[model samples]
Target: MAQESKPVAQVDVRNIGGIDEASVTLPEGVSILTGRNATNRTSFLQALMAGLGSRQSSLKGDAEKGEVTLVLDDETYTRTLQRRGDSVSFDGDPYLDDPELADLFAFLLENNEARQAVARGDDLREIIMRPIDIDSIEAEIRECKREREELESEIEKLDSLERDLSDLETDRREKVESLEAAREELESVNDELDELDTGIEESQTRKQELENAFQRVRDARSKLDNIEFDLETERSTLSELKAEREELHETIENAEKPDENADRLAGRIDELRGRKRSLDDDINELGSVINFNEDLIDGSGIEIYEGTPSDDPTDALNADGQTVCWTCGSEVGTDQIEATLDRLRELRSDKLDERSEIRAKIQELTDQQSSIREAEREIERAQERLTAVETEIESTESRIADLEDQIESKQEEIEELEQDAESIDVEGYDESIKLHREANEIELRIERFKDEIEEIDDEIDKREAAIERREELKSEREELASRLTELRTRVDRIEETAVEEFNEHMETVLEILEYENLDRIWIERRETEVREGRRKVTRTRFELHIVRSSSDGTAYEDTVDHLSESEREVTGLVFALAGYLVHDVYETVPFVLLDSLEAIDSDRIARVVDYFRTHADYLVTALLPEDANALPEEYAYTESID
Candidate 1:
C-alpha cells in the first residue's frame, strides 16, 4: 500500500521585497527554509506575510508592481502591491481580513512587536493587552451601573406600594362595618317615628305645621352633614399638600448645585480634542517616515544615486554610523534616523495613550455635566411643585373655613326650627317632635357612612393598581444586576488569563530548553496607582521576573539584560506563542512564520521548533543549512525557492 500525500500550501511571489520570482510549497507540520545568508529566505517570508494581508512587505526596487498568491486547502488568496511614489499601496483580498493579530503574534519576524518587546524590556502588559478595548468595556460598565440604579429606584417604589396594601384593606373593612351599623340605627329611628301619631282635630293644621317645621329641620341637618363632609375632605387634602410642600422644600435644600466652572469644562474638552487631532497628524506623519526609512534600509528603490548598499544593510547601523537623510537631503547617520524613529514611535505611543485618556475624560465630563443639568431641572421642578402645593393648601384651608361657617349656620337654623316645632302646644305634638329630631340625626349619620365607604373603595383600587407593577420592576432589576456583573469582570478576566498563559508557557519552554543556570521565568500581574487628569486611578501592570541559580545552588533574581541572546530569543518566542494562544489566532490563521533564530544552537532550535509545532497546523521557519540538519528526517525541507 502507498502512503497518502500530506496537505500542502503553495505560495507564488513576483518582485516582492528582494525576491524577483519564487514558488515554494509548504507541507503540514514543520517546513524548513534552508539556505545561506542573502539567499532571499527573509524575502520569501515577507512575500508570505504580504499574501496573509500584512502591509509591511515592500515592492522590489526595479519593479513597479509586485504580486503574491497563496493556495491553501484549494482556497486561493492574492495580494498586489503597487508603488506609489515614496509609499507602496496594497490591494486585494488576502487570507486574513484583519492582520493585526497575525502581525503581533503569528508572524514572528525579527521586527515583530511582540518578540522585540521582550528583548527590549518593553511593557509586556501593554503588548499582551493591546488587542483589548478597555475603554469601551469601562464605558459599558458605567452604563450598566446607571441602569441598575434606575432599576433599584423603581423596585423601591414597587416595594412601598406593596407595603401599603394591607393598611388600605383594613381601612376599607372598617368603613364598611361603620356603614352597616349606621343603616341599622337609621331603621330603628324610622320605626320609632312611625309609632308616634297625633289626634285628628289638632292633627290636621298643627300636624301640617309641625310636619313643615320638622321637614325644614331635616333639610337643614342633611345640608349640614354634606357641608361637614366637604370640610373633612378639604382638611385631609390640606394636610397632604402641606406634607408635600415640606418634602419639596427639603428636596430643594438637598439638591446639588452645578460646578462653578462647569462652562470652563466644555472649553477644556474642546482644547483636548484639538490636541488629539494634532497628535493624530503627527503619528500618521511619523509612521510614513518610519515606513519609508525601513524600505530604504531594506534596499528598495534606493540604488539610483547612492553608494553601493551593504550586503547586510542593518548590520552597519550603529550609534556613530552616518548616512544621507532622505527627507532633508542632508548627510546624517543611519543610527540617528533609527533613533529618531524610535523616539517618534515612543512619542506616538504616548500621544495615543494621551488621546485615550482624553476621550475617557471627555466622557466623564459629559456625564458630570448631564448629572448637573438633571439636578438643576430637579430643583426647578421641585420649586414649581412646591408653589402649586402651597396654593392648593391655601385654597383648601379657605374652603374648610367656609364649610365650618356654613355648618354653624345650618346648626342654628335646625335649632330654631326645633324650637318652633316644640312650642306647638297641642296633644301628642311633643312626642312627635322628639321622634322627628331623632330621625334627622340617624339620616345624617347614614349619609356620612355612604360617603366614607365610597372614598375607601376608590383608594383601595388605586393601591392595587400600583402594586401590579411590582413583578415587572423586580424582573428588570434582576436583569440589570446580571449585566453589571458581566461588565465589571470583563477586564479583570482578560488580564488574569494573559498573566497565567505567559507564566505557564514561560516555565514549560525554560524547562524544554534546559538552560543550565536559569531557574525560572514568570510574569506577575500587579496594580499601581496612576494619576489621570485630576484623579488617581488604579491600573494593572505585568512584571516579568527572571530567576537564576548560582554555583552554590542559591537562586537569585536576574534582569532581562543579563539573559544571553539565545535565552532572550527563546523567551521572546515563548511570549509570542503565549499571545498567539491567548488570542486564539490558530483558529483563524493556521500558519506561524519564524525567522532570525541564528543565535540559538541547532539542537535547542530543533527542540524549540518541536515545541511550537504542536500549536500550529503549519510552522514555517527559515534556517541556515547547518541548523536545518538538526531537524528530524520526516520534516519537509525546501532548500531553494523556484
Candidate 2:
C-alpha cells in the first residue's frame, strides 16, 4: 500500500510593511507556496529557522556549540560538540526525539559545500573533485579523434580514385561511339558515289549516240533532195504532154459537129427564103389593089413603099395612088421604096451564103480528125516513174527508224559502262578511305581503354578491401581510447576521494565528535594502458562510497549531484540542524537568529520537525501565511508563529 492521506496545515498572512494579508491552507506532500514579488513573505520564514531552545543554541561549533535545530521528530536534545564558550550534556546526542532521518538529504548538503568535509562516505566525498578528473578523459578523447581523422583521409583518397576512373570510362565510351558513327557515314557516301558514277556514264554515252544518228540523218536528207529535183522535172514534162493530148482530143471531138453547122446553115437559108416570099406577096397584093394609079417596078434594086413595119404603109398611099409617111412625113417615092426592098433581099442572100461556107469548113475538118497516142504514152511513163521514186523514199524512212532503235540500245549500254568507270574515285576517294581507317583506329583505342577501365575497376575493388581493413583498425583503436579515458577518469576520482575523506572526517568530528561511516571510504587506482594488443587493467580503479549522519546517529550515504530543487534546499536545512544540535556543547547565546528561513522550503522544514519535535530542548519556528501552509504531515504541529 502507498502512503495514506496526511494531515494538512493552514496559515494566515498580513502586511509586514505594505503587502496584502494573503492566506491559504496546504496539504502534506511537497506543497509549493508561490506568489508575486515584494510580498515580504520570506521575512516571515527567516524567523522560523531560529530554533535555539537555550542560550548555547546560537553558538557556532568553532565558536561555542556545533549544531543548530528546528522543531522536528517531537523534541530536541543537547548535541555532542562543545565550542569555546558553549556547554554540552551528552556524547553528540543533539536530537532528543529524533527518528525522521534521511541519508540522501544529508549527502546532498555536504557534497555541495565549499568542500565536502562533513560526509563520512568516500563516494559521497568524491563528488567535490569531479572537475579535476576531466583532464584524463580529454586525453583519451583526443586520441580517438585522431584515429577518426585518419579514417576520413583514407575515404577521401578512395573517392578521388573512383571519380578518375568514372571520367575515363565516360571519355572512352564517347570515342567508341564516334568511331562507329564515322564508319556508317563512310559506307553511305560510297553508295552515293556509285550512283553518281552510273549517271555520268549513261548521259555521256547517250549524247554520243545522238550525235552519230544526227549525222546519218543529214546524209540521207541530201540524197532525198536530189531525187525530189529529178521527180519535179519529169512531172513538168508530163503536164505538158497531157495538155497537148487533151487539146488534140478536143479538136477531134469538135470536128465531128458537121450537123451543128448544117443546122445553122439551113436555119439561115429558111429565114432568107421566107423573107423573099414575104416581099413577093406584098408586091403582088399591092399590084392587085393599085389598078392604074401607080406604075409597078419589078427591079432587084427597087423596093415597094412600105413604111417602118410599125406603120400601115397601105394607109399612107393616098387615093391618087401614093401618100407620104405619117411618122417622118417623107415623100413616098417609088424609087426609095424599091431600094429598101432590094436591100433587104441582098442581106438575106449574104447570110445564106456565110452559113453555107461554115458547113463546108466543118465537113473538111471532120474528114481530117485523129487521136494523140504518142503524147498519152509519154505522160503515163512519167507518172509511173514518180510513183517508183516515192516508194523508195518510204523504204528509206523505215530503214532510218531501224537505225534509231539500234542507236538507242547501244547508247543505254555505253551509259552504264561510263557510270561504272566514274564510280571508282581516283582522287578524293583515297582521302575518304584514309579517314575511315583512322576512325577504325579510334574505335580500337576505345576498346583498349575499356579493357584498361576493367582492370582499374578490379584495382578499385582491392583498394576498397584495404579501406575496410583500415576502418576495422580504427574501430579497435577507438574502443581502446574510450576505455583508457574512462580508466584515467577513475584514477583521478580515487585520488580526489582520498583528499575529500580527510577533510570530511574533520568536519564530522567537529559536528558530532564521531565519524562512524568512515569505514565505507577508500581510494582506488583507475587508469589502464593497452600493451601487446591487450588491455592491462587495474584492480582498484576509483573512490570508495561513504555516508553522512545526524546527531541522533542517523546515516546519510548518497550522491547529491542528482537531487531535486526542494531536496537541495532541505539539505541546507540539515546543515543548519547540525549546528543547532550542538547547541549546549558550545554554548554562548540562546537564539539562532536567521533571515530568509523559507530558503529551505516548508517540505524540508516539516522533515526537520519530525526529528527534533520532542526536543527535550524546546524549538520555535515561524509561519508566513504561505510557508506555514506548506508544512507536511510529518511535522504538521511543529510550527509556532512568531
Candidate 3:
C-alpha cells in the first residue's frame, strides 16, 4: 500500500515534448501511469526527467521553448529548454549538479542506453561503467600518494626529534647541577679570602701583583685554547667541503644527457590529443543522431513537427512497411536503421579504445620527458653545488689560517704572563698568593658553568618546541593515511559492489519470475589483456553467463543471443539497478522512472515493479492497462493526464 504520510514530489511542465502544460504530484512508492500509447505519459516522464537535470528531453514541436519545474523537499528546481535554429539549449538550475549518473541509471526509459545495450548486444560493462571518470580518480589517487609521502617524511623527522628529548633534558640537568656546585665553591673561596689576616700589608700587595700576573697568564692560555679549537674546526670543515666538491665533480661528469627525443614525443602527444578531440566530436554527433532517431521511432510522432509534410500520414510507412528516414525523407527499414546504429556504436567503441591507447602513449611519453628534465636538472644542480663547495673550501682555509695566527699570538702572550707570575717576589706572601689564585680559579669555573647552563637551556627549549609539533604532524599523517586508503580502493570498491549487486538481484528476480529450467543468470567481472593500438593492456569485461537445466536436469551454459526479449530487458534493468545502487543515486535523486516494459508479461512486470519498489523512495512506472491491473491495487494509479 502507498504510504499516506509520504511527501509528494510535484512537477510542472510547459511546452515539453507533446505536453503543453501539466502538473503532476507523485507520492512515495509505486505510481503507475496506466494509459494507451500516446496519452502524453512518456512526455510527462520526459518533462519530469528534464526537471531532474537530464538533457534527454525535447521541446514541443509547436513551441520554441519549454520549461519544467520540480518542487520537492520544500525546494524548487527549474529547467528550461529553448529551441535555437535546429538544436535545443537547456538552462536553469536542476535537481542534480551532474546528471550523468541519473541519466544512466535513474532514468530508465525505452531508449535508455542501459536498457538498449542488452537488446542490441552492446558492451554491457562499458554502459555500466560510463558514469565513472577513471582519469579523475587516478589523478586524485596520485595526489593523495604525494601528500601521504610528505606527511610520512615529516612524521619521521618528528619521531627522531622526540627520541632526542630525553638526552636534552639530561644534559640540561647536568649543566644546572654543575652551575650550582661551581657557585657554592666560589662562595666558600670568597669566605676564606675575607677570613685572611690583614697583617703584612706589603706582602699582601706583592701577592696581589703576583695574583694579577697569574690571572693574565690564565686568560691568555684560555684565549689560545679557544683559537686553537676554532682553527681545528675550520680545518675539519675545509676537508669536508673539499671532499664534497670532488664528489660533485664526479657526479657532474657521470650524469647522463637528457633525451633528445623529448620534442618528438611532445609533438606526437599533441597530434594524438588533436585526434582525440576529433573523435570526441564524432562520437557526440553519432550519439545525437542515434538518440534523435531512437526517440522518433520509440514514441515521438513526426507529425508533431510543424514543418514536416504528413499529407497521407500513412505514407510515412512505405509499401514495404519501412519508416521514412527523417534526415533524408527516404524509405528506410527499421532493421537497417538499427544495423546502422550498431555500426555507429561499434565505431564509437573503437574510437574510445583508440583514445585510451593514445592517452596511455601520452602518459608514457610524458613520463620519459619528466625523466629527461630531472636528469638535466640534476646535472645542473651538481655543477652549481661543485662551484659553491669550491668557494666554501677557499673561505674555510682562509678562516683556518686566521685562527692559527691568533692562536700563536695568544700562546706567546700566555708564556710571557706565566714567566712574569713565576718571577713575582712572593717569598713571604706565598699563602696570600695561594688564596688569591684559588678564588680566581673558582670565579672562572662559575663563569664557564653559567655559559654551559645557558646553552643547555636553549637546546632544551628547542627540543620541547619540536616535541610539541610532533602531535600536529602525527594528526596530519593519520588524515593523509585515511585519504590515501580511500583513494586507492575507490575504483575497486565500486567494481566489486556493482558485480555483487547485479548477481544478487539477478538471482532473486529469476527466482521470483520462475523461469523454467533457468538455473542462473549472473555477471562475472574479469580482466583480460586486449590489443589497443600497438600495445596490449588489461581491461575489465562484464561476462554475462547463463546456466539452464536441460530436461535431464543437467545444467548447461547459454549465450545472450539465445535469451528472449523479455529476459534481455529484465537483465538490462537489473544491470541498471546495480549501477544505480553502486553509485548511490538514491541519495542524489528520489525518483526512479521506469518506462516501456511491454516486452515482459503482465505478471512478470508486476513482480519486477514489486522488486524495484523497495529500493527507491518513489518508483514511477508507465504501464498499459492490463499490465497496471496486474499490480497490487494499493499502488497509486492514474489513467489519464490533462
Q: Which candidate do you rate higher for TM-score, 1 or 3?
A: 3
* Candidate 2 runs further than 4 Å off: 1-145, 156-459, 466-474, 480-484, 487-642
lDDT of each structure? Answer: 0.79, 0.38, 0.78
Best by TM-score: 3
Stretches > 4 Å off in candidate 1: 1-15, 20-31, 47-53, 62-85, 89-98, 196-479, 587-591, 633-642
TM-scores, all models, native as reference: 0.72, 0.20, 0.77
Per-residue lDDT of model 3, residues 594-632, tens digit only: 987898999999999999998788899989889999999
Clashes of 3: 0
What TM-score number comes out for model 1? 0.72
Could you give candidate 1's per-residue lDDT for residues 213-273 as a string of tens digits?
A: 8888888888887887788888888888988988999999988777645567668777877
Report the C-alpha lDDT of model 2 over 567-619, residue by residue, as the tens digit. 33433444433323322211222222222344455554544444433321223
Better of 2 and 3 by TM-score: 3
Clashes of 2: 59
